[model samples]
Target: MKTELDYLAELAGHGRISRRAFLGRAAALGVSAAMMPALAGKAFAQTAVKGGIIKAGLQGGESTNSLDPALNLSQVTFSFGKLWGEYL
Candidate 1:
């Protein structure tokens, strides 16, 4: 017997949906997640800025920012988030 949740899942069409549909469902949950940061962000107290600042010396690579986080040395590739930051 299919549970109510199962029926809902089927209505989403045989358990397969387009990226747009998946994103729609995700967007609903995303709104709540997004709101929590916006609404509750102020309830938490703020701390004073510490004196230290981080400085990375860019001896190599272009100054341009690449959205591909997985960029590596000597080849072109599709990149997504990874264990290490981007490289040449």
Candidate 2:
């Protein structure tokens, strides 16, 4: 199915899954091996840059706003700050 092909392509595109794995899955799904390269290219083209700041411009924050775990003021800030911390 196209969806399965797309999923495999996406994993390969992000380098989370190997090309061999993608091809194997694709074949098992009845996709032709000759189509692998095109699928790979499409997947790679849609991939985002590997690393960068994930910015969330949360309004209503003041200079007093703190990212400290003990001082998280709101759920949005807490979730965003948690994610940003993980990106480091």
Candidate 3:
């Protein structure tokens, strides 16, 4: 998943940054967090609030939140640690 950032960061030699790491940094830089909403509003600029539920099959998933939940599940379940693709 070589995203726009992978190229940009690679140009800057930002090292091997995973998507999550890139997102965390971008949020810190106000890229996705602050700008995405604004861009969504400006780009779409509509009142239609389209919405849908994302049901992740929790049968086997990964959690990155806290160990409390991991304690009750496998370390390598379906690994719902994060998202990608359109949902991302």
* Best by the lDDT measure: 2
Worst 10 residues of 1 by lDDT: 74-83
Per-candidate TM-scores read 0.24, 0.45, 0.25
CA lDDT of every candidate: 0.40, 0.75, 0.45
What digit string (tens of lDDT, one per residue) describes model 3 on residues 1-88? 3365445355334345544564566565557565534322332233544565657655544444343434445534324333212442
- Selected candidate, larger lDDT, 1 vs 2: 2
Residues 1-88 of candidate 1 have per-residue lDDT tens digits of 2253233334344435443453355455444434433422333334655454434444444545464644544222222223123332
Candidate 2 Cα misplacement greater than 4 A, ranges: 42-88
Candidate 2's residue-wise lDDT over 29-74, tens digit each? 8877787788888554443456775777766666776777788877
Model 2 clash number: 0
Worst 10 residues of 3 by lDDT: 37-46
Instruction: Output the better candidate (1/2) by TM-score.
Output: 2
Off by over 4 Å in 1: 1-31, 61-88
| Stretches of candidate 3 exceeding 4 Å from the true structure | 1-8, 11-15, 33-88
